[model samples]
Target: MPIASEPGPGAAPAGADPVPQFSEWRKGVAGVLAKVRRVEIAELPDEPEHLLDETTYDGLTVAPLYTRRDELPEHPLPGAFPFVRGGDATRDVHRGWYVSAHFAGPDAAEVNREILAALGNGVSAVWLGAGERGVPVADLPAALSGLLFDLAPLALDAGAATAEAAERVYAALDGYDTASRKDIQVCLGAAPLTSRFADAANIGLAETVTLAAGAVARAETVCAITVDGTAFHNAGASDAQELGASIAAGLAYLRALTERLDIAAALGQLTFRFAATDDQFATVAKFRAARRLWARVAHVCGAPDFGGAPQHAVTSAAMMTQRDPWVNLLRTTLAAFGAGVGGADAVTVLPFDSALPAGELGVSKSFADRMARNTQLLLLEESHLGFVQDPAAGSWYVEELTDALAAKAWEFMQEIEAEGGYSAALDSGLLAERVAATRAARDTDVAHRKTSVTGVNEFPNLAEPPLSEQARRADRIARYGATFEALRNRSDTYLAEHGARPKALLVPLGSVAEHNVRVTFIANLLASGGIESVNPGPLTVDTIAAAATEAGAPIAVLCGSDKRYGAEAGAAVEQLRAAGVETVLLAGAAKAVAELEDAQRPDGFLAAKIDAVAALSGLLEKVGA
Candidate 1:
């Protein structure tokens, strides 16, 4: 299962020209960049490479611009070796990817109803969550009682009970009247390694291979093992880490399966699942990279003729927010679009309210479920996104990102292999450590607003009514906005106890035009933490104390231009303090309040790029929320 290191086919030969035909274009772009710097960035000291707008993600640098000079020298066509473009040479324009719906159940009847509703509407596949967190092993038969086994493929996630669940599915299929069971696809979802890591469930690898042999004996088109990356993704692994881990797991399964079966047969028994996020370009590149990485693995195993890696893309659960749940619709739509365009064989969009408590073991035909199903349907039928194969094939950015992501993932896989494979890496805590590091970095970005979660960290609506509570499946994901949501939760509790939300007074030190920007900034920041902002507009220094006293706010923030702040902020803070405002803050920078006398200076400052979580948490604490 160890792949040899070698340069990819697209690598440039020795002494080849790196930037053919771009001299004139480069000069023109340079001139435009210089003009931009001169006109807009005159205040900042210029640097040699100041004009470039590069960003990095998962250790890959994304250049501001790409040209033919940046393109790889060669790219294999669709359905060719190392199928980066796509696994299929052609796809049905009417139906590009399988519309897969996910269901979890402890109740068979409820699961059956959801499955039927999904299939009837538009879903082409069913991903059933079976076992302890999902359907009971004994209830599999009743859960899938009326499902058409041939028309709708079944993928099971049974954790420790995978073997039993597969047997039940086979038993149910035994009663089918179809002449060829091979027409139906079944993914038995056996991942001993991932299941062990995520749920501490020990499923035997040898037993899983034995089940695959049984499936092959029955001439069933069955994928006995699923290398699911969502477990790692939800645990906060970056895209490359998730891909590398998944590939490593797939290789491990292949080695075990190959002991009893040939290379091609073992290949047939495996499938992949990846998480698709709202970062559309990254999601597309990640899936495309997955295909390329596995194709290389297949080639190394002497099975170049294997069709492609079977991929099932699920919208990222880690990106879903509990505070501003409605915005999840847009996130899932973008993610689903990316998955489809990236050539996922099947795509699953989790319900918009998936993070909320639903009072059930599985999602049913609620409005959220219907919306999730219809989102994919609309992409296929209305948007006609399925009308093309490898829609991102020729874009320079996508191609470059695909190559970069694939290489990074391959490097990660090699690291795991060097550490004695995935199991040893897990045992030694190497895998968890790396994932934790990435999660920490991501959490820092969210806290500082470097990464914005709309409706949670960005434009939160404090007045929005809460969704009704229901029992929901237990999850352990570290959601990006969970910290901000915690503050909102405390605000909710305060509201319930005190009969009103905590309030902060906004003391504008000048006219509306002079203070509008800082005023808006302070107001939005307060709302994100569920605190109300009481703005007594354009208060004079003489009237500010009375306004603060009348509002009965425990805290007051001074908002105005830097000039206005220097002119009147010290006096405003003094008056606010006299009026019993427990704390005074300036919305401008700390330097604006630095010249004031110690007694007149505000307690703190609020400005851009601050650690929003820490600031909001402190505000809540100051107000006794």
Candidate 2:
């Protein structure tokens, strides 16, 4: 049950003299920490803990520093029991992990063309959407017409029609020789729990279990079930929650399969799917912990020597933004790197333009698909990311995170078991309740700008042209920047109706140098809500009324330093009000607003760390947007 075993400070050879430089290294680290603490205390004397203390949504406290002094867990080598390092003992340095591309099609010929192109262009696997939102079940043959079964592995995501889709795909493979069929790898993707969680009306659990058993019996090289965690992850489950729910689902499948097959065969029949996010270290740790947790499950099921769980990592759809979607390329690159380094067997990087409707953002589907696949190719060929086994194996931070995350995930699995099981918990709404709480906390952080989402919340570019339609994602996961994107959509509507965007008049009360910083801050905040800022430069009280009138803005914000606010903001607010600026606001803290006479104080303050969504929403309403 030990997670890993490695030499550390305590593992020095018996009677071996301690390294003479050890004391010196400790002293050097202490000296650096002293200086850091002094600076932190000076900045936040009352709460300096904030400088070195951070906690993730999963409730894991991130230490500012980790060292050999930390009690590290003992893990076996890669491909060993518990498999924290990796499932495989070694991998081909040249080939690395599988590069999988996703294809969702309602047309058979079109999907066939894309599949062929993807395979020809370095894709090792194809994840086809086979029914409902994808290719019709009847068209599965045409969609897979020319696909060479032995060359490219196939993964099917058929939602409610998984049984029929799996049947059709199997039927297509009947023409191949038995040896060829054995060489073909397919994932039947029969995820009843994920499907039912995503939609209440999905197929029943007993039926799905029966179908999966039948498929496993019929399959040669097919994984009859996938314990997909993306539904919970997209629904705002934290990393630990996703892992726990997935394992619970996996266990449920194992139990069902054992009724027909042995434990080892059942274990081999299931694969796990997790979402890979831009949080690289967390993503890496999540994947590592998943293997450890699932390995423990197999060990307990009397299959101690079974290989670790096969993981398929898909870049998070929830993290993709509809605005400035080009940034998604960067996001997915980091995520793919995490997935690769964390030892995922296969990774699917959703196209950067995934949040936009096809062909609506001037990006062709073929171009986007090519970019997504090539991202992995470049990482594999150019960056050589997969040249090593268990790349993060020895890092103190990663190992400790992996251990702690596994513990937390195990606790969540226990909670689900206590609530009867994964299915029972989902039916009782326990899973949804927990996910909602986590989502609320995340939304609060985003709203207050504690979490910066580039191009949507921080450093927004209002001048960027709007998409022709509101952003549409097939998955329907709630994006982190959706609130800001909604505001942008409203601005687009206003612009199309009136040929111009709503504007806010910024009244600066001091010299440009004294007010420029606040001016920039206020302007960026306003633009994030799709409103433009019309700054008339540093204005005198006498000029404020005329500037507000000339700008013709219903809302005016005073931008200045605390000194300038005390000296000139009162007069500026009064003048702007006299000029019929319906809503007057200040750019500084609430204390600055209170320092003004009650009669002259602006309506509100736009200080750092304010609830940006609420503030922007109020401003948009006042500006008639």
Candidate 2, 1-625: lDDT as tens digits: 5544556666657555445455565555555655866643234434333356689998998886666545476577778888877888876678788999988879999999989988999898899997785899999999999888887789998877878887898889886555656768888887887777777234556666676667667646788788889988888889999999989888777777788788888888889999999999999999999998998898888897885868999999989998888899999999999999999989999999988777867878889999999999999999998898678876889988888899999999999999998888988999889888888888888888898889998888887887675353234586788888888878887888889998899988778898899999999898889998998788888899999989998889898889878888888888988899999999988787566788899899998889999999988887677
lDDT per residue, candidate 1, 1-625, as tens digits?
1224454577557676555655565565666766776643344434323356555547788776777556554456677877776777775678789999989967989999989987888999999989885889999999998898888889998878889998899898888778877878899988887876676574688899898888777766888888889989999999999999988888888888888999998888888999999999999999899998998899999998683868999999999988768799999999999999998989999999888877332445477888999999999999999898788876889988998899999999999989999888889888888889999989998988889999988899998654333312235897888888888877887887799999999998788999999899899888888899999899989999889889999989999999988889888888999999999999978897678889989898888889989998999998788
| Clashes (N, CA, C under 3 Å) per candidate | 6, 5
> What's the lDDT of the predicted structure labeled candidate 1?
0.85
TM-score against truth, every candidate: 0.91, 0.92
- Candidate 1 lDDT at 183 equals 79
Residue 578 of candidate 1: its Cα lDDT?
90
Deviation from native of the Cα of residue 104 in model 2, angstroms: 2.2
Candidate 2 TM-score to native: 0.92
